[model samples]
Target: MAARLTRWAIFSVAVSLIPLIFSFIYLTTVGPTPAFFDLISDGELLLISVALTGAAIGEVIDKKTARIKSRLASGGGCFLVASLSSSYFVVVSAQDDVRKEIVMGMSCALLLLGVISAGLAMAASEGEEGG
Candidate 1:
């Protein structure tokens, strides 16, 4: 169960990071994606992913190095930076469309996933607690 939860947390993190590159490609080539989608692909989602990763690492600190937590957090932050980069063109290209809202919505969804994943990871890390 712990391993399963850890996998799930990592999966969520991966899913959140995907928007950074995928959304950019979709928006650039497909001509104006939704804001909700854009948001899902941004730093906010990545931040949440990072926070969750930190928590997961914290849970496992007894078996691993403490530095891994900070490192993974930085990795999430890097994803955030990548996601934010898409904003440069997205803002100027789609002004009056529903792009912003959709992107923001997506970002929130990714964030939600990240938070939930973090909780699960933290919970799973408790060696004595066998869920």
Candidate 2:
């Protein structure tokens, strides 16, 4: 399980970096534009959310000590918190006023999903310890 988790983490990190690399290349080739930058930012945020969720899932599957599990849960919680803030900022910074409400609504839904994933990870960890 631990090995599988490690592999997953590595894969996720690699996948997350692809957009960043592309964004850098795009910025260097074609002058920066607000819309383009915003699109890249949104893509990055979505990738980050996926990576964090992957980490949480990995931690839950890993057969680690209770202390490690607790730490992993806390770390996942922190990531979710950061993601929530970033999502809110994305919605605020969006240029389309009409879509702002929709973006905010989606952000709230993602936040709820993050919270649920974290809760599940923690619960799974606890269950492993027969607690």
**CA lDDT, every model vs. true structure:** 0.52, 0.55
Which pairs of residues collide in model 2?
Answer: none
Model 2: residues >4 Å from true position, as ranges? 31-47, 54-87, 95-131
Query: How far in Å is the alpha carbon of 70 misplaced in model 1?
Result: 22
| Model 1 stretches astray by more than 4 angstroms | 1-45, 61-98, 129-131
TM-score of each: 0.36, 0.38
Candidate 1, lDDT over the whole model: 0.52
lDDT for 34 (candidate 2): 34
Candidate 2 per-residue lDDT over residues 27-106, each given as its tens digit: 66787543434444343444455555656656655646556756576556646655665666565566555354455455
Give the distance in Å from residue 42's predicted Cα in candidate 1 to where it truly belongs.
Answer: 6.2
- Using lDDT as the measure, the top candidate is 2
Model 1, 27-93: lDDT tens digits are: 7787765555444533355455455555554455543333455545544543453344335335534
For residue 36, give model 1's deviation from the true position in Å.
Answer: 13
The lDDT of model 2 is 0.55
